[model samples]
Target: MIAANNLSVNRGGRLILDQVSFQAKKGRMLGILGANGSGKTTLLKTVTGFYPYQAGSIEIDGKPLATLKPKERAQRMAVLSQDEHVSFDVPVYEAVALGRYAHQQGLFAVKGKTDDDIIRKAMEETGISDMAERSLLSLSGGEKQRVWLARALAQQPDSLLLDEPTNHLDLARQVALMEHLTKLLASRQLTVVCILHDINLASLYCDDVLLLKNGKVICQGETQSILTRGVLENIYGTAFHEWKEPVKGRKQFSVVTRV
Candidate 1:
């Protein structure tokens, strides 16, 4: 499990996050939601140790996140950021294999058959096996995103952090990725904390939801409880309409706007 207690962060003398507290348990996906500049990205970065916090603590599986060595941390957690860029042209296979570095004995360690198998499995799972030999630069935006996800999967971390993972994908691909994550959560028991702008997608896939407004957590709880039209309207300052799916009985919502 990953937990943040009274976490706070400041940048350029301005507070970005304030005393935010939440926990993502094993085998569950936690969706972080907010409007622009609500510190959604900042919270993810702080929990992953990319940004130093001014107060509070982050723990992973009962161990202080700060105390863990770099390799140790990488072995337990993996991050998939919004940007997917490669300075030089890199083969898809090579890019995904980078995740295994934490498990390597040394910088020059030779990759054995086990490493190859894991890479192959990751690529296959993400539906990029056929593109293994292609240059990452040649792939489309959605394809590149899938490759990045495959790389993170190859890491085989206990917890995965994703920032706007569905940004470049179409509706179909977006749903497919969420379904894949659901399988990963149930089969591998992977804990996921994802930053999402689409409230409907969060409602469909998230087991828990954390709503933030102006760097403060407005509410956090089961997805159904926290994502009511009132709470969403208060946080986004917009009107919303909600309805239930006739087949699944799941609640679906849409923003209401007048021309």
Candidate 2:
């Protein structure tokens, strides 16, 4: 499990996060929801040790996140960021194989059968096996997102962090990615913490939700409890309507806008 207690961060003499606290349990999907500049991305980066906290602590599976070595941390957790860029024209397969770097023995370590199998399966799972030979620069935005996801999956970590993964995806692809994540959560017992702008998607896929406003946590709990119309409206500064899906009986909602 990933847990943060009284976490705080500052940048440019300005507070970006303030005494934030939450736990992402094993075998559950935790959705971080907020409007832009609410510190959603900052929190995720702090958890991954990319940013230093001014106060409090972050722990993964009872171990202090800061104490872990870089390779050890990579082995335990994988991150897929919002903007993934490939500087040079590299084959899709090669880019995906980069996830295995933590597991490699040395700079010149030979790829083994286990590594090859994992890479292959990751590509196949992301529906990019056929594009293995294609250049990363040649793929569309959505395809690149999938490839990045596949790379993270190849890490085979106990926990995964995603930052606005559905940003460039079309409607169908967005749903498909969420469905795939749901399956992976159940089958692999993966602990996931994702920054998502789509409240409806979070409602459908998240086991827990954390709502943030101005770098502070406004609410955090089960999806059904924390994603109510009032809470969403307060955080997003917009109106919302909540209802259950007739067939699935899942709670779903939409923003009400004035035209």
Candidate 3:
């Protein structure tokens, strides 16, 4: 489990994240929701050790984040950034194999049998096995996005920190990605903390949600309880209509849609 208590951050003499706190448990998906500049990204960055904070503490599986070495940290949690620009072209398989770096010793690390097997499994899980031979630069945005996810999976992490994992996918693929995540969560072994813009998607796939406004957490809890009309309106500063989704019975909010 990953938990942050009373976390605070400052940049350029201005506070970007204020005493924000939340927890993501194993086998559960936590969605971070907010308007622009609401510290949504900042919170994730701080937890990932990308940004330094002034107060509070971060714990991963009962170990403080500061106590773990960089490699130890990467071995436990993998990140799939939204902007993964492949500067140099490489084959998909090779890209995914890079996730094993944390477990490798020595500067000239070669792929072992176990690493190769894990890489292939990750590619297969993400449905990108067929493109293993293809160059990263040759694939489309959606395909590259899947490749990155496969790389993260190859880490065999207990937790995933994703930033807009569905940004490049089409309507159908977006739903497919979320469905795949749900399937992975079924194992009750992985934790997902995703930053998402689509409310309906979060409502359908995430078990818990965190709503942020002006660097503070407006509300954080089960998706059903935290996505009420009043809470959403207060976060986005706009009117929204809330209703149960037809098939799954999850709550969904829209600014202009009706039940």
Candidate 4:
């Protein structure tokens, strides 16, 4: 299980995250929903040890996250940030192969058949096999995003942490990416923790939702329970409408007013 016990983070004398606690188990997908500046990114970074916390603890599979070596931690978890900047002019295939660095015996070790298989499979899963030879600087935003996701998948992580993984993608691509990721999570029993801006998408994809307001989790439960019109209206300060879908017979919620 991945867990945070009283996790807190302060930046430049300002408290960004405070006493936040949550848990995600294998086969579970946790969606974190919040408005801008609510510390969603900060939480993800802190959990992955990218940012230092002021207090509390983070653990993965009963081990302290801080105590784990860099390679040891990368073996268990992979993180996808909202924005990825690649300064190098590396080819896409070589970039994805970087994920195998942790599994390698040394810095200059050659990759074996297993590594090749993983890289190929990950590229295929993310639908980026054709772009494998393209340079990272030559691709569009969505394509670059998928390439990064493929790299993370190539790591063969037990858990994933994503910050708006589908941002800037078209509707079809967004749906396809989420479907692929959800399938991987279910089949591999991977724990997924993600920060999503679209509540509707989160409702459709995630098993559990954690609603945050001003850096604190206001409520958390099953997606269908916490994604009601009333809760969203209060949290986002907007008028909302909720109704059942005509075809699927599932609850459909939408924002109706700016205020």
lDDT of 2 by residue, 45-142 (tens): 99999998899999999999988999999999999998678889999999999999889988898878999999999999889999999999999999
Poorest stretch of ten by lDDT in candidate 1:
243-252
* Stretches of model 1 off by over 4 angstroms after superposition: none
Q: Mind sharing the TM-score for model 4?
A: 0.96
Give the per-residue lDDT of model 4 (tens digit) for 1-259.
7999888899999999989998987898899988888889999999988999989999999999988999999999999998688888889999899889879997689999999999999999999999989998999999988988999999999999999998978999988988887898889999999899988778778889888788788888888877888888777888878887665455667878654
User: Clash pairs of candidate 2?
Assistant: none
Q: How accurate is candidate 1 locally (lDDT)?
A: 0.93
Give lDDT tens digits, candidate 3, residues 131-185.
9999999999999999999999899888999999998999898999998888887
Clashing pairs in 3: none
lDDT for model 4, please. Answer: 0.88
What range of 10 consecutive residues in model 4 has the weakest lDDT sum? Answer: 244-253
- Candidate 4's displacement at residue 90, Å, is 1.1
lDDT of 3: 0.91
- RMSD to true structure for each model, in Å: 0.9, 0.9, 1.9, 1.4
Model 3 residue 185 distance off true place after TM-score fit, in angstroms: 1.9
Model 3, position 43, has a per-residue lDDT of 86
Clashing pairs in 4: none
Better candidate by TM-score, 1 or 3: 1
What does the lDDT read for residue 56 in candidate 3? 97
Better of 1 and 3 by lDDT: 1
